[model samples]
Target: MTMMSLSWSLVSIANKKQQQIRRFKITIHRLFGFAFLCSISFFLFSPKIPRSPNYHQFADMRNLLGVPNTLNVITNFPFLVVGVLGLILALEGGFFTISSQAEISTWILFYAGILGVAFGSVYYHMKPDNNRVLWDTLPMMVAYSSLFSSLVVERIGQRIGLGCMCALLFAAFTCIVYERIYDDIRLCLMFQLILPLAIAAVAYMYPSNYTHSTYWFSSIGIYLLAKLEAVSDKKLYRANNYVISGHSLEHVCLALIPFLLSVMLICRERKFKRLGDLKDQL
Candidate 1:
């Protein structure tokens, strides 16, 4: 072939390769999303593990009549259902894809659950008459919020959710510091170190999109912030030793995985963009 024909052939081949790589990534994301949904559903409702006595006792706060826990569960129930369904829809994007409008509609329902959790927690806390209601429901709210943001929200919505998540981490961090200063380091370490690391692990394990890296970033920031606070306060020694208060190596592992994955993802995205630019040149 002439030089010109050879060059054109190679360019066409490269473009085709980029398109195939993009499709493969999309397929992997969808399959992983479905698998993740199944695992999370199991974690939430599995019968093998014993239920927390506190969770049941809290449920019994009142009769099935307008009890807060019941009400809380019912009112916020749609989010859970939609969350599961969204994962299915996300999976369908792998096969019989829905229209973009349907996907957007599903996303709206999905993010509603996320924002509800943030707002719901504030509501739950303000009612001192129902501390049990607040405490029992808050964890679910936080969990669903994190999962919803990670799995559902898109470009703009993802950024908004990230801002909210950072606010939560900052609030948690501030509380930990204040508690450490006036009360004790124990509370701070638990809230700051343990909680962040746990969050990092959970977020890392979740099958999320490119924009959702904020969740991972926030998780790491929370840990890094806690570590800084501990060192500044001369509590690193306390954090590393002792049976109860020490920051374990396990926590370090949790933060590291997600942080490393975040780096890997950034590199991959840049590479994808470079390929797209080359395609445009053709």
Candidate 2:
């Protein structure tokens, strides 16, 4: 065979290998995610035995929305472990597929996990008069920092990375607005929005002509929609603390959609006519 044809054949084989890898990773991710959900479901469905709010006090239904007692510190182990696995899978997705952008998914999951841990440490384990457990929640900040680093620093040289970071910043802002409107605002909102946007803008200011402006624009749009959903969680429940409506499913779906798409962008087989040919275009 001619060298050109031989090269094409090798490329074909490599493409197939990458696809198999992507499929395997995606399957693992899904299965682990299912297990995580199932664990939560099992805990939720278990009979509620009333007792002191120390060992399993926070295990009851009232604590599902947030931490109620120190038991959460113990109960959170299953979720924390599952979340760690999910984070690994997501990091692989980021490496393997632009369409998947596992960092995005990882951030969402990481956020949830850290939040659970933090809420539990702050509300359950800590003393009402003496505050010491507050420091235990620092993982939340670390997780956020890592997320921005992946999008802004790790993906900096590449066009797609820039686009993804831009979109994420926009989404973060949208979340801030939504939370503010819903009256569920937290001091963390300002830090989440401003710090990331500042970093992304500085990163983008360096002049360069790229083929994939669409990725940035599209990401921004998607992020706006997603943030709207995330912030809407503020309005999801009622005064009684019961989840009567507007639960977190929308936010999860929105976040997951971009994440999965970003993964596909990286790992899927397709024509490379132009950068824009890929939906992740980032």
**How many clashes would you count in candidate 2?**
16
lDDT of 1 by residue, 1-282 (tens): 455765686687567655644554564467558645755685466533322333233211222464543333343344344334443444445322222343334333334443444345335523423333334234433443343333323222344345545544454556444543554333333333334443454455443324435645654665475455423332443454422211222223323433343343334232123344555765
Q: TM-score, each model?
A: 0.28, 0.34
Candidate 1 residue pairs in clash (backbone atoms < 3 Å): none
TM-score of model 2 (CA atoms): 0.34
Candidate 1 deviant stretches above 4 angstroms:
1-110, 129-199, 202-215, 223-278
Model 1 TM-score relative to the real fold: 0.28
Worst 10 residues of 2 by lDDT: 51-60
Clashes of each: 0, 16
Against the unseen true structure, what C-alpha lDDT does each candidate score?
0.41, 0.42
Residue-by-residue lDDT tens digits, candidate 2, 106-163 = 4554445444444444453434312232233234334444454444423333343444
